[model samples]
Each structure stands twice: as structure tokens, then as C-alpha cells.
Target: MFGAVPALLTYYWCMKMPETARYMALVARNAKQAASDVSKVMQVEIEAEEEKVDKIGTASSNSFGLFTREFAQRHGLHLLGTSVCWFLLDIAYINNLFQKDIFSAIGWLPKAETMNAIHEVYRVAMSQTIIALCGTIPRYWFTVVFIDYIDKFTIQLMGFFFMTVFMFALAIPYDHWLSNSAGFLIMYSLTFFFANFGPNATTFVVPAEIFPEKLRLNCHSISAASGKLVAIVGALGFPYAAQNKDPSKTDADYPPGNGVRNSLFLLGGINCLGIFFTFLVPECKGKSLEEITGEKEEADANDMQQASSTQTFPV
Candidate 1:
């Protein structure tokens, strides 16, 4: 019920929003509506260029389907970069799934068995709130402020690198942190900080900006879906994988396994993989959508006039 409120609000706002001018003009071939939408948003008069839209649409190169050889040659590396980076990003879902165990191990939160249900809920909520306040929320704003200045590729690479560093710092010396709860909390919080400030934010932005307007939504959906699929797998698998090898410490009915220390090591390795794949995604900062996706070349090849190009709002 609580989740439904935000969903309903999002749906309402999305419904009210106009389609992007590029999508309206190119894919839907509705230059008039595209011009009108852009005019309203920019608060300037703009004429529809139906003839220009038709010319661009009829270009054989721009008409390629997503799965065609042309698209493969053009954007296959991009799709692979977006999809794999998202996949690697969500592999860190293990951090969320096992956060409580990590906290208890460091003596931050009391063990679940020590508290009644209400008390357990209170402690868990408080701990999560602290992590969010100290780590998550601040980093989101950091991305918003620095994304343009630093660029997406640099931020993501830096983020994944630091997250990898912190994960190993926590795991490699797991016993040392157990004795220093404050130090452990700081390190744990840093992981969350870099995760948000780095690939978590860029992954979403890059897919939207890098794909052609016609294929943007589909490509973004595929990238996001890959992330979500990995998240589900991490949620289900990490618990068992992180179980203590000592039978006495293992959860009821769960077999002993590599435990949280090794699990953090694995997650660190995944973040390292994210760094490698980040190279595959092109830097889209300071480039227009058309330039990034090669739509400008198609328009120029057709000898499109400046006035017609402006009317299409080739963002």
C-alpha cells in the first residue's frame, strides 16, 4: 500500500508529460506535435518541419532495427557496456541483503535473538537510517552537483575503484573491524557513498544519453532490467553464500559456507569487474544526443537546412 502511492504519483506525472521532441518527430513521424511540445517547454515559437522529418525518417541508415547488422556494428559495444555495468553494479546487492549480519558481526546492532520483535525492528531501522543519512543521501546530491563538472565516465570509474577498495578493506581485515565498531561503520558507509556517487548514478544516465532517440527507451529498459535481474539473484544467493562456516554460528536449516568475510571479498571482486566494463561505455558529457548517437551525421548527409534541423529539435 505504501509503495503504491509513489507508483501512482509517478504514473500520473508521466502521463501528463509530453513525449520527447526527438521521439515525436523521428520515430512517430509527428513533426507538428514535436514542435508544439518543444515550443511550450522552451517558451519560444517553433514551426513544424514535416518535410524534414520525412527526409530523416526515409534515410535507409536511420531505419535500421535494433537487432539488425547495422545496429550491431554501431551500438553493440555500447549495449554490452551498459548492460554489463548495470549487471555488475547490482551484484553489490549482496551488501544490502547481508548488512544486518555485517552490523551484528561488528557489534553495531545487537544480534536478532537478543531483542524482541519490536526492539529488533527499532534497532534495524535506526541503523539503516544512520547509514542512509551518513552515506546514501549525501552521495546522491554529490552526483547531482558534480556529474556535469566531472563527467560520467570519470565519476563511475572513480566510484567503482573506491567501492572495490573499501569492500576489500572491510573483508581482508574482517576481524580487526569486529573489534572497532566505529571504524567498521565508517568503512561500511564509505562503500555506500561511492556506490551511489559512482556507477549507480552514471549507469542510469549513460544509457539514456548514449542511445539513439528512437532506441533510447528500449536500451535504457534493457540496461535497467539487467540490473534488476542481478539484484534478485544476489538477494536469493548471497545469504547462503555468506553463512558462517562454523556450524554453531550458521542460521537454522542453512548450511555452513564461506561467511561474510569471503562474501565481501566476492563483492569487492564484482566492483572490480564493474571498473573494467566502465571503459566500454563512451563518455557522453558535453555532447548533444544527436552527436553521441550519430544522428547529426545522418541529418548532415541529407543536406538538411539549418531551419529544418532547428525545427526538429534534434536533442
Candidate 2:
């Protein structure tokens, strides 16, 4: 019921929001509406570029359908990069949901049977809050401050590299951490820190900037959907994968498996893979949207070249 209030408030505000200026101008071919929207927001007297919009709309180079060879030729590698990175990030990120199992295994958290329902909820919530305070929230501010100065690619690369390091650091000496819960909590917190600071932030932003205006929404949606799909798989699979291999240590009604140490190693390996995929996304810092996508330049040049070829001079 509390969640419903926020959802209702958001819905009211979302309904008043206009379609993006880029979408209006490019895909909708409504340069006037686009100009109007921008003028309202920027509080400036802006004229609609109907001729420019018409030229772009008529250009064959810009008019290709989403599934055509042209799109593949242009953005295939970019799409792959965005999709794979998001998929890998979610795979690692979903482990947060299994924190209770992980904490119990490491002796940081008490077993569920030791506490009543209310107490259990309080303990779990407190652990999650600690992690958020130490790891997740601070890293987000760090990303916000440095992203413009340092570039998304470098931040994401650094994030994945550190996450891999921390995961391995926790996994390799798993027994040691079992005795030292403070050290374990610190290392565990670092993973969430780098995650928000790295590919998690870049993957969402890069997809929007890299694709052409006409296809931008589709590409971003595809990338986001890929992440969501991996999150679902990871949520369902991680608990089983992290189950104690020894029958004596295993939870009731659950089969023994590779255990938490191996699970951390697996997640670390996934973060390592994210580093390579991050190379696929291009840096868009300080560049115009048209410059990054090459849509405006390519379409304008094609249209001009075509006009030049078809022109007839008076004899």
C-alpha cells in the first residue's frame, strides 16, 4: 500500500511529460512539436527546422528499418557490447538477493531458525542497510562526481576489475573470513560498491547515446531487457549453486552443491568477462548525440550528394 502511493504519484507526473524532442523531431517527423518542447524547457525562442527534418526523413541512408542490413552494419557490435555487459552485470548483481544465505554460511548472520519472523526480518534488513551505507550509496555519488571527468569506459573497467579482485579476495580464503566476519563484510561490501560505480551505470547510458535517434529506444529497450532476463536466471539459480556441498552444512530441504566459495569465484569470473565487453561500447563524453551516432552527418551528406548528381544546369 505504501508502494502504491509512490507509483500513483509517479504515474501522474509521467502522464504530463512530453515525448522527447529527439523522438518528436526525428521519428515522429514533427519538427514543430520538437522545437516547441525544447523552447518551453530552455525558455528560448527556437524555430522549427522543417526543411532539415524533411531532408533527413527523405534520405534513404536514414530511413532504413530497424532489422535491416544497414542497422546491423552500423550498430551490431555496439548492441552486442551493451547487451553482454548488462547481462553479466545482472548475473553478478543478483547475488545480493541471496545475501541471507551467504551471510549465514559465513557465520556473519544467524540461521533463520534461531529467530522469530519479526526478528529475522529486522536482522536481514539491518545487514542490507549496512551494505548499502558502506558500499552502494557512496559509490553512486563517486560515479556521479567523476563520470564526466574520467569517462564511462574507464570507470566501468575499473569497477569490474575491482569487483573481480574483491570477489576473488573473499572466495580464495573463504575459511579465514568465516572466523573474521568484519573482514568478510568489508570485502562483500566492495563488490556492491564497484558494481554501481562501473558497468551498471555505463550500460544504461551508452545504449541511449550510441544508436541513431530513430532506433535508439529499441536498442536501449533490448539492452535493458537482456539485463532483466539474466537477473531472473541468476535469482533462481544462485541459491542452488551456493548451497553447501557437505550434507551436514546444507539447509533443510535443499540439496548440497558447490558452496559459497565456488559461487563467489563464479561471480568473480563473470565480472572479469564484463571487462572485455566494456571495450565494445564507445566513449560519448563531450560529444553531441548526432556526432556519436553519425546520423545527421551521414544523412545530410548522402542527401546533398544525391541532389548534386540529379541536378540539371541551363544549357
Each candidate structure's count of clashing pairs: 0, 0
Tell me the tens digit of each residue's lDDT in model 1 across 261-282.
9999999999999999999999
- Give candidate 2 misplaced runs (Cα > 4 Å): 299-315
Give the alpha carbon lDDT tens digit for every residue of 1-315 in model 2: 797999999999999999999889878999999999999999998999999887766655468878998888888889999999999999999888779888898787787788898998998899999999999999889988998898888988998999999999999999999999988999999999999988889888889888888888899999999999988888888888888899877777888878899999999999999999989888888888877887668876887898999999999
* Candidate 2 weakest lDDT stretch, 10 residues: 53-62
Clashing residue pairs in candidate 2, if any?
none
lDDT values for all models = 0.88, 0.88
**Candidate 1 ranges beyond 4 A from true positions:** 1-3, 301-315
User: In the order shown, what is each candidate's alpha-carbon RMSD?
Assistant: 5.2, 2.6
Clashing pairs in 1: none
C-alpha TM-scores of all predictions: 0.92, 0.93
The Cα error of candidate 2 at residue 211, in Å, is 0.7
